[model samples]
Target: MHILILGAAGMVGRKLLARLAQDGQLGGTAVTRLTLHDVVAPEAPPVRVPVSLSASDFSAPGEAERLVAGRPDVIFHLAAIVSGEAEADFDKGYRINLDGTRQLFDAVRAIGEGYRPRLVFTSSIAVFGAPMPEPIGDEYLTAPLTSYGTQKAIGELLLSDYTRRGIFDGVGIRLPTICVRPGKPNKAASGFFSGIIREPLAGQEAVLPVSDSVRHWHASPRAAVGFLLHAATIDGARLGDRRNLTMPGVAVTVAEQIEALRRIAGDAVVARIRREPDPTIERIVAGWPRAFDARRATELGFTAEPDFETIIRAHIEDELGGRIAA
Candidate 1:
């Protein structure tokens, strides 16, 4: 199978590449080639298959066309600006998230002649807004509060319409905020969720930007990749008209997270998390959905960590090599 990964340079993108390279196959099929693209050229993964890397603004005229010209068997669309960045820059958010997504879908449709490939889009739970139910269900309305959520919600709608038209098989997974994200922080409003655990485990003081009472959904990066793989290989017809599904995750408050850190990593690591609220981040997070039922995703074989402690341990095992600050 031939695979193409957009946003191949980002943290999740890089992890996906490492996983594919390590496994040497995707969905039980041998990978024959890889086409990696991003705004900046993505580093070529050390895979046995032939690999091509491109760096360009895909939203620019004809750029998306060039990407789909090869008719890769599966396309993983992981590209987009983060929540904080998207909210702060309205024009940029629309251009990259909304316009860019539309362009890619149209480009694939233009490839007519029975050239329909599986498209796995990485959406976010931010697609749902505040004043929401405790465990948001598959039937819940997607009334997003932030520009990033709005863009992802629109993407979900487009994916459904295009799939209904037999243009391509698409599955949109609405991911919760990924905890214990490895690497320096990006501009996402949810950055603190990972920062509080990641920095402290690495022996650095980290800031807690929100209240302890604030609760939210979370999954480890490993689980996120598993969702992508399942989406790529699953029987799309089972999804019916609802091509988008909210992924499962552990739901907990800030206090629960800190307690989890204290449980596994000791009190000192937890102590490193200093409480210093940021009004801007708090406002943005307040609009996001807290927990999700995710019944359909679980029934369809998608899974995540059962609790926040598992999330922290997974990060330590995967990124920290079973080592932590003493």
Candidate 2:
């Protein structure tokens, strides 16, 4: 099998690459070649399979065409402008998220007869807006309150329509906020969810932008990669007309996250979290979905960390080599 990964330089993308390289196969078939693309070239991993790396803007004219020319057996679309950045820069968000997605889909369709590949798109729970049910169900209508969410919702629609028309076998997974993200904090509005735990465990202070009672869905970085892989390999026939799925995740509040940190890393680490409310972030997060039913995804064999405690331990083991600051 040949595999193509967009946004290959990002955090989840990098982890997905490591998993693929380590296993050297997908869906029980050997991956003979891998293509990695992003705005900036990705560092080539030490994989036995032949690998190709490209740095280009897919939204730009002619670029998307070039990307799909190879007709990879599987394509994982993980590229998008993050929430805070998307909200701040409207044009860049729509251009990269909406226009770019259309460009890629069109390119695949233009390939003509009998050329369908399995396409896995990374969507977000941000696709659902406020006035949400406590545990948003699989049947909930997407009413995005933010530009990032709007783009992802539209992308989900496109994926469904294209799949229905047999252009490709597509699956869109609405991922939850990934906690204990290993890296410097980026501009994503949900960064604080991971920051509060990650920074404190590393003996650094982190700011909590939202209140203790503010609850949200979360999954570890490892679980995010698992969702991507499952989407790539799952039997699409069972999915029927609904090509998009809300992935399974644990729902916890800021206080619960802190308690989990305290349980695993001691009170000293928990003390590193300082409350500094940012109203803008709070407003953005308020519009985001706090929890999900995700029964559909769970039934389809996609899984996540059961609770915040397991999430924190996964971070410590995976990113910190199971060691924490004393």
Candidate 3:
């Protein structure tokens, strides 16, 4: 099987690439060729499979057409402007998030003669806005409060419509806030979700923007990669008309996350989390869905970490070299 990964330079995309490289296959078929594309050149990883790396803006005129020329069997679209960045810059967000996705989808459809490939899109839980139920269900409507969410919701719709038209087999997974994300914090409004746990575990002081009682859905980076793999290989026929799925995740509050950190890394690590509220971040986070039913994704065989503690432990083992600061 030939695979193409867009946004291969990002965190989730990088992890997905690593998993694919390590396994050397997808859906039980060996990946013979892999193409990695991003706005900036993605560093090529040494892999047994033949790999091609390119840097281009897919939203730009004619770029998407060039990307789909290779006719990959499986296409993973994981590119998008992050929440805070999207909210701050309107034109850049719409151009990259909305236009970029449409350009890619249209390019695929333009490729005639039964060239339908399995397309996996990484969406965000931010697609659902405020006034939401305690545990948002699979049936909840997409009422995005942020530009980033709006773009993802639009992409989900396009995926469904295109799939229904038999242009391609598409699956969109609405991922939860990935907790304990490795590396330094980025510009995402949700970065604090991971920062609170990741930084403190490194013996570095971290800021908590939201209150301790604020609840949200979370998954580990490991679980995020698993979701992508499952989406790529799952039987799309079972999805029916609704091609978008809210992935399974653990629901917990800030206090619960800190407790998990304390449990795994001791009180010293937990003490590093300083509560310094940022109204801007708090307002943005308040509009996000606190939890999710995700029964559809669960029944479809997608699973996540059961609790916040497991998420922290996974971070320690994977990124911290199986050790935390003493």
Candidate 4:
């Protein structure tokens, strides 16, 4: 089978690529050809499959059209601006997140009759707004607070409509904040969640942007990839009119995270975290959902981290070669 991964150089994109490359398959489907696209071209996959790399902006006039010309068997759309960047730059956020998504949808719609490709989109829990009912369910209303959330919520609607029209089989996985992201921090307010754990494990100092009592939803990078794979393989007939589902995740407080750190690496690493709360971050995070029921995703067989300790260990194994030595 053929597969195309957009934003192929970003952190999640790279992890997905590495997972596919190492496994040499997705959901037991052998990938005969893989296409990687990003603003800057991505490196060739380490696998021996026929790999194509290209640099293409999703917002450019003809870019989306060109990217989908091959009509690969499956397409994983993982490109988007982070929450902080999107909130700070409204125009750039809409241009890429909204307009770019529309352009891709239009391109797929333009495909000839009987052309149906499996489209897997990576959305986020930001689709929900403040004053949220705790443990937001899959049926919860999507009243986004920020422009980034609005764009994603809008993307979900478009995907459902397009699939309804028989244009393509689409699945939108509303992802949780990925914990222990294996890279330098980005502009996302949730970056601190990963930063505090990832950096400290690397024997580096990291910042804590909110109070230790702050709690939120979380998933591991491995679980994120698993969601994509499941979305690609699952029977879309089971989705019916509701094409999007809130993903299962572990809910834990920042204090619990520090405790896990102390358990894993002792007091020295835990002390490396400095608490200097930023109200901007706190405000942004306050509106985000703390937990999700995710019953639909669970019923559909998507898995989640069992606990914070499991999440931290997955990060160590996947990102740090299974060693927390400082």
User: What are the clashing pairs of model 4?
Assistant: none
For candidate 2, write residues 262-295 as lDDT tens digits.
8888999898999999999999998999989999
Residue pairs with colliding backbones in model 3 are: none
Mark the regions of model 2 whose C-alpha exceeds 4 Å error after superposition: none
Each prediction's TM-score versus the true structure: 0.99, 0.99, 0.98, 0.97
lDDT of model 3 at residue 172? Answer: 97
Worst 10 residues of 3 by lDDT: 43-52
- lDDT (10s digit) by residue, model 1, range 252-286: 99999999999999998888988998999999988
- lDDT values, one for every candidate: 0.94, 0.94, 0.92, 0.90
Give the runs in model 1 whose Cα sits over 4 Å from its true position. Answer: none
Q: In model 3, what lDDT does residue 283 have? A: 92
Badly placed stretches (over 4 Å) of model 4 are none
Model 4 residue 208 CA deviation (Å) reads: 0.8
lDDT for 318 in candidate 3 is 95
- The TM-score-based order of candidates, best leading, equals 2, 1, 3, 4
Query: Which digits, one per residue and each the tens of the lDDT, describe model 3 over residues 143-225?
Result: 99999999999999999999999999999999999887898898999999899888887889999988999999999989999
The ten-residue window of minimal lDDT in model 4 covers 317-326
Cα error, candidate 2, residue 86 (Å): 0.4
